[model samples]
Target: MEVKRVRALAQRALIRRWAEDLGSPSAGLATVEAIRSHLSRWVERRHGTFSFRLTQVLTGHGCLGRYLHRIARREMTSSCHECGAPSDTALHTLIEFSAWGPQRHSLAAFVGGDLSLPSVINAMIDSERCWKEMVLFCENVMTQKEAAERERENSTADPLRRRGPGRRRLRYGHLLLPP
Candidate 1:
């Protein structure tokens, strides 16, 4: 009984720490709401194979212009590169981007018009083909977006300021070591 109590307490502490971390503004991930909504439980089986593209699409942390502009400061605006949507969020790219109209329409047709995240998730779980479709959609969209972003950066006034993946641009304040 004592061991069980201690284990339960430890689990509670871990969950509390995770919640606090997720709430932090500098958590580096912008999909807190999505993570909380879709992936909070540990026991649930994930439907699709994991990939970087899928992670980017689901977490809103990749080359999407909104993420680039707001979180990474890599873009001047959060507009979609193709359609110029005011904010190029993951959902916007997935569901509404005119550039991806054919793919989106195909996906929507497959899922019967319910393009919400929950519906997509359920579709993926319900069919392997749906999972593959989702993966393909993410790959197609993210690859094009990444290429466009690279081209934009290279054409910009200061391409040298662009940091590669896993590298953070250091500010003057970040140059100092903590005492």
Candidate 2:
């Protein structure tokens, strides 16, 4: 079925479910109806027909009903590991992470620095410039993680690597003798 039709049907079903849960007018059916109408209007105002599914996936909501609840709560936050900054909000994390200054500089160098989050998101969704940069960023992070893991492994396996080869012996890369 078309997505809009599906969404409308889902909304209708949700309103019905809410109404059923209320059981009778004594249970405040009018309030439930008002809420449903408000939500439908909100969906229309925000162009939810085009983005409801994507927003659900990105925001960790698996269904339209859950996504609507999450949006209503405005629940978004993550703590920045680098600076202990609260990077919970979408805009803050995307545009204002303390560690993001350098990362954004790097990204801008590769993709144009002045780009905004919405533009970047659009680019990523459209498989444009920001998409390429996102891939590069992931690669760089993976490479750094791999390097750190190798260093950790090497350090644990051979402490002499932390010291000079003079303390041990030249294995493959360099030639150094103990002084």
Candidate 3:
């Protein structure tokens, strides 16, 4: 087979594998599911500069309390620290958290009504202004959340309760070396 054709076949297979993974109920990729709804192909490119805060809001993989609780038990509860919601997931933080009411209202205006992840994403894709508005909202909320997290860590008197900035994971009872 030609090299170009071979590469195309490989790419298709990879995309198919990713789609299967994303669809699996066991995969637990709720945020990725939101992005998948907007994609034309399994691996379409989005136009825009990437920002950490925006990615966190879209992916639910960052400093969000639910994610933090799940990943490393860094948080005592998955509830929103600001509003005490059941889960501090990305959707909750962006759309439901009362603390971000002002910013959410601003973003909703650009999104054209009540905000859903898909609506936020659609608005972002349709207009650069909307994209900026969403990013700004994510930054504003995430920054405050992060600052509060840091303050909590610093104020705690227990040394064991304080978290280190570096990440460490145990692998078979041994610490994995940081890359």
lDDT of 3 by residue, 21-85 (tens): 67765543665676666554424435556699988877787768888788757877788777778
lDDT of each: 0.74, 0.44, 0.76
- The weakest ten consecutive residues by lDDT in model 2 span 60-69
RMSD of 1: 6.6
Please write out the lDDT profile of model 2 over residues 4-50, one tens digit for every residue.
89988998788667656655545323333433434433333422122
Clashing pairs in 1: none
Candidate 2: Cα lDDT at 109: 64
In candidate 3, list every pair of residues with a backbone clash.
none
Query: What is the number of residue pairs that collide in model 3?
Result: 0
TM-score, per-candidate, Cα-based: 0.68, 0.30, 0.75
Candidate numbers, best TM-score first, in rank order: 3, 1, 2
* Residue 145 C-alpha lDDT in model 2: 30
Q: Which runs of model 2 end up more than 4 angstroms from their true locations? A: 1-78, 88-93, 109-111, 125-129, 138-179
**Could you give the C-alpha RMSD of every candidate to the true structure, in order shown?**
6.6, 17.1, 4.8
Give residue 75's error in model 3 in angstroms: 1.7
Best by TM-score: 3
Q: In terms of lDDT, which candidate is strongest?
A: 3
